[model samples]
Target chain A: MAIEVRVPTILRSYTGGAKVVEGSGDTLSGLIDDLDAKHNGLKGRLITPEGGLHRFVNIYLNDEDVRFLGALDAKVADGDSITILPAVAGGALGFAAAAALLGR
Target chain B: MTPGVPAVGTATPGRAKSHGNVRHVLTIDSAILDAIVAHARRDHPDEACGVVAGPAGSDLPTRLIPMDNAARSMTFYEFDSIEQLRVWREMDDNDEEPVIIYHSHTATEAYPSRTDISFAGEPGAHYLLVSTREPDSTEIRSFRIVDNVVTEEEVNIVDATVDA
Candidate 1:
């Protein structure tokens, strides 16, 4: 089955700065394996040697996180969009700007 | 408005936190965070947010401070300060802090990303992350940015309604 992988803005560097990537994978693991074969450093970042996904990454198959199902090995259907999400912290824009306004 | 942190940061010596510290944090599941992320993904990826509120006593349920995500989705979140102040003031009126400041990782997981750490600088604010790509299976971690050092901790989310 063919799936489209959506990359976050941060990891876009690995995909030649492309936001969206299309590939084929019957299962979620197959999809990632195919992606890593083409993209450098993405495999280490997404999947661990144990075959489980990295702690900071969440793999969504067709808008649903595979972890909620059975995780990395979760099966995928055709036209699935597996989104790889890197864990990010708080977005403290206003606080910083406020501090700056306060001259801190 | 950063929340999910104990005001106890400054109540002690050495333990007191400084601003911009995203490391002194506690982590929680990202299920609740997903609600916020989904909200942002639905209407405006740029500006779609909310507020969280709880009762004055323990018996009440913790509520979300859902607000308008009107700021540019450029790594950081922007809210109406007056509205935030009002929420906090109301919290003060209720005798509880918001306890969580959250935003979405539209294409990422529910962890503190570089941009999130760069922007995270609240003294007693615990950073909460919502991953849009991974719904329900989210991660929430708390942090304290003290003089540029980010300290993290784990916050057990017993129920999707309240934080521990």
Candidate 2:
């Protein structure tokens, strides 16, 4: 299953500066694992130590955000494309206050 | 969809002061600056954010795409994920890149806070800030934030007449 993965500029170092790379898997999680095997340390940037999708990293599968598609368990098929973008977020508030405001 | 500005004559690049490896200057259109300040005031109390896209590698800001601040908090701004995806794809299709990524601070100065530094992901774009704290006055500033370091840059606003 050849899935084309689009890498954002910030994460291009892991792909040897290549913008697009290929991987194989039936699910997004498996695909990432396969990608990490070839790219090395790419998974650590996408997934958190707690085993959840990083809030600051966005993954889309064929125009649908993976978060809305059962996140890591989202199914992927051959020819599907994955686009990863670092979330653009920030503010004047501190992380503690923002976290409290988020009730997390 | 954010409105597209007419393709005006290209303005000369601003004179950047050398600061080691940082180029400390952002040459922008005056009308675009006004639009940014207007958006900040309009969304006062809640932060407003947007991106200004230009030709890839041009570094000249020509398109103003105001993004929805999904967080909608007075002290924070986050581009809605889905909208961001669409906008990014649009840029890619048009052979454009984000030249300026801007946001407003309702209660603080036009400067990046710690959180802003932490979440800044675009190394190639200027991080513009607008302060709407004063009812009668607004402060606009620009910066280059890379590798967890923030360096203030001079904003050179070209008059609308010159561009038209």
Which DockQ values do the candidates obtain, in the order shown? 0.09, 0.78
Please provide, for model 2 over B7-119, each residue's C-alpha lDDT reduced to its tens digit, 9 standing for 90 to 100. 22323243232211125678888899999999999999999999999888777888999999998889888888899999999999999989899999999999899888877
**Each candidate's TM vs. the true structure?**
0.41, 0.88
lDDT of 2 at A1: 59
Model 2, span A14-67: residue lDDT tens? 999998999999999999999999999999989989898876678999998898
The TM-score of candidate 1 is: 0.41
lDDT, candidate 1, B1-164, per-residue tens = 34845564344445333321223334333465456556766743353445544443322225567765435554445554345445545766777644456666555555565545654433345555555554445444545544456666645443343345
Chain B TM-score against the true chain B, each candidate: 0.57, 0.85
Fraction of true contacts retained by every candidate, in order, equals 0.23, 0.77
